[model samples]
Target: MKNKILVLGSLTLLSASLLVMNSCNSLPKGLKTIQDFDKNKYLGSWYEIARLDFVFEKNLNNTTAEYSLNEDGSIKVVNRGYNFIKNKYVASTGKVKFAGDSNEGKLKVSFFGPFYSGYNIIALDSDYKYALVAGESLKYLWLLSREKTMPNNIKETYLKTAKDLGYNTSELIWVKHN
Candidate 1:
């Protein structure tokens, strides 16, 4: 009876762990990752043109992210930004792996060990010059471009798309490249 009870407890714990891990890859309702995503083409530097204000990026300007292939088949994510208030540069390194199909832009990224968050590329241009990324929920969104500045047309279109998807576009903080 003791052995049976122990086995049951272990199984229960394993089930719960799997559930938590899977939830980290979930996308927000009505949001979708781009199909036919070419990871190789997407792996490069991107400037943060706009984003919804978040604690990790608070008071940050001139932000950028770089991605490279890691030896372990994961993507290395390096984010750098200038903290105007702190008068210093800040950076964070993380890892990203495809959440499901490699052809899809659905990924899970983790800066902290054993905890992952959704990184869904909701929109991307054919040339890979601009991308609109959404997080696990409506509260997280980013407008990324290969250059420091995005074209006005692209910006307006992305904003409209975000708004259509129930995002609060007004809450976005336009990041300064300088």
Candidate 2:
């Protein structure tokens, strides 16, 4: 009877996890992603100018992310950052694939196998030099650029865009670069 109960509990947990994963594909009301995104143009290195303080990347600086196309059509994601407190460089390699169609800018990225998080390109400059990325909810947001520091005008615009999307722009932690 104990074994049966354990099995039932495991199945229930698995179902809930699957449900959450599926729900990540849809953005909450009032949030939208860019249209006609070109993955090839976006492939390259990006510096994280600002971000929310998530556990995986808390207290990090000089953060950068590189993207390249894998032979199998998936995107290879390499993230590097300097942990000031640890006095070391931290890195994580992952894979990203479009959530629905490549043109939509909605992506699913996985650092740990089979477990993906949302990577929605909510905003992008016309030249593709800067971008704003969002995750499954308002708690996750990132401002990225080809350079370490973005212009004040651009930064204000992106912050405003995020604010309009229900994110708390004041909570953004600017990443320092050496």
Compare the candidates by lDDT and give the number of the best one.
1
Question: Candidate 1: where is the Cα deviation over 4 Å?
Answer: 1-22
Ten-residue stretch with the least lDDT total in model 1: 18-27
In candidate 2, what are the lDDT values of residues 30-127, reduced to their tens digit?
A: 87888999999999999999998899898799999999999999999999998988989999999999987889889989988877888999899989
Candidate 1 has a TM-score of: 0.88
| Candidate 1 residue lDDT tens string, 1-178 | 9999999999999999867865767777888889999999999999999999999999999999999999988999999999999999999999999998999999989888767888999999999999999999898999999999999999999999999999999999999987
**What local lDDT does model 1 show for residue 44?**
93
Q: Give candidate 2 regions above 4 Å deviation.
A: none
Q: Per-candidate TM vs. native?
A: 0.88, 0.95
